[model samples]
Target: MTQLTDPSGQPPYLRIVAGIRRRIMDGELSPGDRVPSTRQIAKEWGVALATATKALTTLRLEGLVEARPRTGTVVAETAPARPPRRPSPPASPSEQELTLERIVRTAIDIADAEGLSALSMRGVAARLGVAAMSPYRYVPSKDDLVLLMADAAFGDETYPADAPQGWRSRIELGARTLWAVYRRHPWLAQLGSLTRPLLVPNLMVHGEWMLSALDGHGLDPTTLFDIHVLIYSHIQGLAVHLEWEAHAEAATGQSEDQWMDSRADVLRELVDSGRFPTFAKVVGAFDDGYDLRLDALFESGLKALLDGLAPIVES
Candidate 1:
């Protein structure tokens, strides 16, 4: 039993489990033979001893191995016997057992893998393997679906009911949580234009929480609500680029770097020609190349915005 090279870089526990499973199925490790001791497995597989132990535990749980007192862990006697496989549960219609709740979840998955722009009622129905008109039972129109999706994503997260020690702390937490939700579903940022505002209760709850955070700042209710929308816009405007980048890559099968490389010569020549000295100088500041770190950009931009708003709060 020599250590095998793992190409996928799977976690050591999974690799170790995979190794043992391969040997058992190959009949190299016979049924009822004493399986390797955790120490022996550790040495042979070059994995940590704890990982080897967990591998054995997984095998035991799967009924492929067992521990016998005074005999150490051995392959289970029933290892070769095939267990009955459970049948998959049947799918239900969107109206029969299907609800708006279930339809929204499926839509979320589509937006998660593909960008939100890729989402359509027909696409969602195709995913459910149902007729295109079927989703209309749960969502009246594509606009309604988008609204439901936004609310669904917003609802998945819980806000801290207890206020932080300070307003700034409270504001930062809410902004960061909202940022995270958008990153999880990048299409969410595009939904913030206030065109009817989705009318979803969960998003309204999020807005309410933000308004409450600013209660003591002396801003009028309208001003406070406007400020919250402005904050959301700032974060979402930058985040929309993330969705664009994703969509571009998926459509063209080109990464950001690859896209830049394709246009590198033309861009470099244009900047270096001295037609735009300030643009050239600024672009040169990033010789190492610019990679978007969404979390860092969100934090820095939010902090700057908050700093700018401090005087407004005091006034």
Candidate 2:
């Protein structure tokens, strides 16, 4: 409750760091204790959120604090002697240092760490420590930046020169490759839907790979493209939930498992109601509760899909 400040006129963030550091050293905040969050620090110190974030970053660099996923920042297990003070804001990169590739890569990193919803031009600029409008000078707009991000994300993996031999193996390779990209960047799946597909060139590279696998199978143009789309949709449909689950957890402060467990009573009521006998039997059959592993589901679905399409392509 006391005011936090240093008499020597240190910056506001440094003063906050000194206060929290004092608490940790004096055993007022023990190891594993939840330290004041950025929001809390901002409120208590009457400084901006950016300043609070910088204070925490400084503490983290010094090994005095660590961030836990669901849990906020906590005092680290050990606190070493404080490192020498650094400037409040590190020098921003020169204009010459800012390039389109750097901006796109930084934006992708933001979307990967925090969902795409958290991304913004200003936020990206702040992370880059540049002016608000700096990225726009390169990217023009967030939508364009997202397109570039998706293109880069999709281009991460490619088909090998020695193709997998069989058409089915080739198809599996392409599908799994795309799946890996989605798993790496879950936000990629949320970019476009079947009705309005993403038209990026790198994405088309994936499409080309899959279509080429089906190319010489003697199928007509329509059927060939249809098969390719079906396979793509299979990977993408399940992938859409990845980002959705992330957003749900952030919004509700509960993981998907926690949220499902919370609905046990409702699940029991449904079982007892007996309106859906098959659903009840399935739910009751699990000795240990089912763990929804997306990777396993992706593989299972891919196998089933390829099996079904085998006769069509082979015919």
Candidate 3:
């Protein structure tokens, strides 16, 4: 039980903080264990994203949780002195220092470390060590902030002025580069869809690279753009699972391998039941078990895609 009986009109975020803190105190959520992501908190408690973000932010400030690289937020290894459950106001800072670039950079860091749903304007400001509304000064809303963040993230990589020798090679390079970004920042793939794309300058740099490559290769404008979209879809289609799996792991408190192991009996039953013979045969062949390497999978798919595109480009 999380001590939530208080009748005072305390904000929702403080109650959230207390519940999680109770979890920590009770040993249910141990040191080195992953904490539920902001998305999970929001969904479970029926609070807004900002409220969930604030709760985590308050916990972090109080030393109950610490943001770990590669791993999302986790319980701090050693507890520090208990501070107030509610967050204190951030110390005032000069307003002249804030800039659009700094805001976007901080937002990208948050979205990369945490998932996109974890992102909030207040969260970004907290990360920047400024007033909660500071980010709003430069980026009007969360939506506009996301647009700038996408542009900055995509701008991280660009093609060389002298392009690759062949159109296929250029396309491969472009796809790999984009995949690298998504691999680093999985949240980027979940941005706008293929039909309603984000039309920003930096992202357009990539579009221009691919579009230009497919341009003089005998395909009409529509077909050229369509090929570009197809290649992008290949990356985005698979990239969604990257963040989703991460989110699921954090929320469920189980790694993929751990979760699968828990279902081993079910799997064995399925294998022995004789319904999925081909599945059993293939899985049974791997004594050491199969390793699902997304990197290898991406490379394999990219190669197959380029092979299919070869005839069209070469023609």
Candidate 4:
């Protein structure tokens, strides 16, 4: 039976899992069917978003639900009934050979897979099969752990020691490389602002690349660094949305497209009200709704930014 409440005194998330699991097993929710979103689950069950998220995470770990990029979480087509991801406790802690490298890598994996906010030292220890406080031996705290994680993430890609001829090409290479890192580690953008930037050595390699490219372009030191900061800001600004979108999906249990679609009625009312003639005209011409491809947007904006900078380089 679908559990309306946790009469068995199980945790709220477990109760959610039981109710959803029952629904799935009884063939009520077929393959690829839209499941109740996190918001809907929270509302119906009177639980917080995190609890609802945990329930969904449990389902995903069990291979029951899978998150689709453009679609929200849905029933897996041929999901195997399996246990959730909490592994067996270690028989001997020494067998795992835990080290600072392992600790940072595990932290990175968690940040990369889930997100920065989802990360906790205890969680890293759990994944590493060690005592909850074991990670404290190597990385003292979550803040320091994140710094190391960001350093490792930034170090993943490197530029050639040999120079590309033009400043534009070099700048493009640097921007794209940094973009790839951010794309790989979306959580990286969430840390530090332009004013209070991430000062780790690995991250400075990218700044060095940008600064080197702008060096001989007749611009003074301030102007050169200004241009560098502008380029960096462009990438960071757009990249922040990557994490935001991911969190939004987890919280609302709606994909970007789904969320936009849900808001269509409101948008149509605003558009048809004739207050936005230019907006309506531009939007009305699309036969198919716009696809918000962040990669394409990144590339397009990069080109425009370079085009504007080309004049400065030439002068």
Candidate 5:
């Protein structure tokens, strides 16, 4: 293959760095696999030797790759797929020395699997196998713990640089990302009221991205901000229901479909009682469907909103 020079407009190192990350994420490189060497990158990407080295250096600093003496360089094995555990650092004498990261991360896992209501310092401590007071040493209060947890969850997914071109695509990406994150940690959607935001930098970055997507759309500032608020509310409102259903199923050990079936059986009995034929017909028509799928509904509604906004944006 002919050696290619770096594209002129974009920085050579950054372009090279993006190419490597894309390969990793796209599964061209798997966990525990060897990453390309600087020499390999230079040859493959057709960039200068120095540019390739800088690309590798940036990837290493970002925790995407690491170097070993015996092995030249390999993709970092510390990502989530590798299963990182809390550092069982030898018990130190000073209890207060325990890092806040461990405490916050543990709490986040709990809130992720279980709902937010299940989280408490005692619960986090139980999970950590540490004394109840140990968590308090790191996090001052449950509110502080939750705030930190929200930030950590948001930090899980970073926005892709040079996102797809066009304003609508950008807004769709932001909305979809936010919705996915909240869906994963459903409790996060319910944490703060619209009036008082989360005060987390990462969450603010989400808002900033949304605001930028609205730029030059010809919407007034109030309408632009309100549109974002509406989108957030639509996603969060559905997510709360999703969390509620999951919690109900977990407590009762019944799948949502089964629970809905039982409720439908009750409704069928009412339908047979010879009153309200219209209601009976409506309920009977939808008996065999799956339970409410909130994520799908959120995506659908977001798309509809975007469709309605397109004409205005183009105008």
Candidate 6:
């Protein structure tokens, strides 16, 4: 089996690990010294976040580095000089066999596992066990690749021919379908905004589904489009936080609950301070500390939004 190499004649992640390992072995990065973060590594080495993450994971496996919660990754106190181990190259077909579909699917998987920030042409090629530029042959650039990914992701679901009856039911199905896609690929919400929407065929399938639901209602075009946009905003607005929370956890090494617990003392003080009685009462009402379930929130918000718009849409 042939080992894939980047331009440097070594796998990108290994090269990164070697660089950091050399720094540790040379005492440049002493024990407990802060090591460059994943973002920093990516920026400094011109690699993707996934590549940087892999380098850090290698170092941790070698016991050369350790994570220090809010402090970021640091050189372990007892660093042993061990040569970096080469990862077993993945079994992949030659670049000649690579297809556009394969490239887009691989890119989507990368963005899904890691955040969108972690995706890059080189990273996808690396995962596919091809040369760094192999993916670029199929996808002109990362931006184009992302658009392909979005289209493919949105295309995952389709409305059945026997669609649910009633405008509200049809609209509900469309909204839930979109929310499900965002739930699967949280990075998707970060792709486009309301003003600048992602104009892709598969996404248009969703838009068409939604717009058609509101059609034949004797409603003016402006009011009809307004309602459509409003519904989309609710799903996209909340979905944006999904990626954000994942990013926060990755950067801070704390889950939402853990991070909130870390600030419990401050929250307790804020609640006890007699300044805001109403706010305190709301905080006091929860039998158990609030667990922010985004799914529940999405359902509740969707129902309320549809309920409020029922009169206008029905009329």
lDDT winner? 4
What does each candidate score in C-alpha RMSD? 14.3, 6.2, 6.8, 4.4, 18.6, 9.1
Model 6, 250-284: lDDT tens digits are 67645576678889899999999999899899989
Q: lDDT of all the models against the reference?
A: 0.74, 0.84, 0.80, 0.86, 0.74, 0.85
Kindly indicate the candidate among 5 and 6 with the higher lDDT: 6
Query: Candidates ranked by TM-score, best first?
Result: 4, 2, 6, 3, 1, 5
Ten contiguous residues minimizing lDDT sum, candidate 5? 79-88
Put down candidate 1 lDDT per residue, 1-315, tens digits, no spaces.
566576865557667776677788888777778887766777788765555655676788678898664356778888855432433433656435656786788899877765676588887876666777988987789888888788889887778657788767878888887787787888887776754555678878777777778888889878887788878787777788878875665454344665677788998998989999998888899956666677788899889988988788767
Candidate 4 stretches greater than 4 Å from native = 1-92
Error of 4 at 123 (Å): 1.2
Residue pairs with clashing backbones, model 5: none
Across 112-222, the per-residue lDDT of candidate 4 in tens digits comes to 767899899998987777899988999889999999999999999999989799899999999999999999999999998999999999999999999988897789898
TM-score of each: 0.66, 0.75, 0.71, 0.79, 0.65, 0.73
Query: Using alpha carbons, what is the TM-score of model 6?
Result: 0.73
Clashing pairs in 4: none
Clashes of 3: 0
Q: Model 3, which residues run further than 4 Å from truth?
A: 1-92
The runs of at least 3 residues in candidate 5 whose Cα sits more than 4 Å from the true structure, single-residue gaps closed, are 1-97, 269-279
- Give a tens-digit lDDT track for model 3, residues 132-203: 887888888999989888888988887787989878888889998889878877998888798898888988
Off by over 4 Å in 6: 1-96
Residue 86 C-alpha lDDT in model 4: 53
Expressed as tens digits, the lDDT of each residue in 115-232 for candidate 5 is 6876899978766667789888877999989999999888776788887889888988998888888867788877878888788988988888888888787888888888888877
TM-score quality measure for candidate 3: 0.71
TM-score of 5: 0.65
| Candidate 2 lDDT over residue span 1-315, tens digit each | 335566765668778888899888888998899898666777788876656766776788689998664466789987765544664652477534888998889889878766788799998898788999989899889999999999999998887888888899999999999999999899999989999999999999999889999999899999999999999999999999998976765555445666677788998899999899999899889986677888999999999999999999999
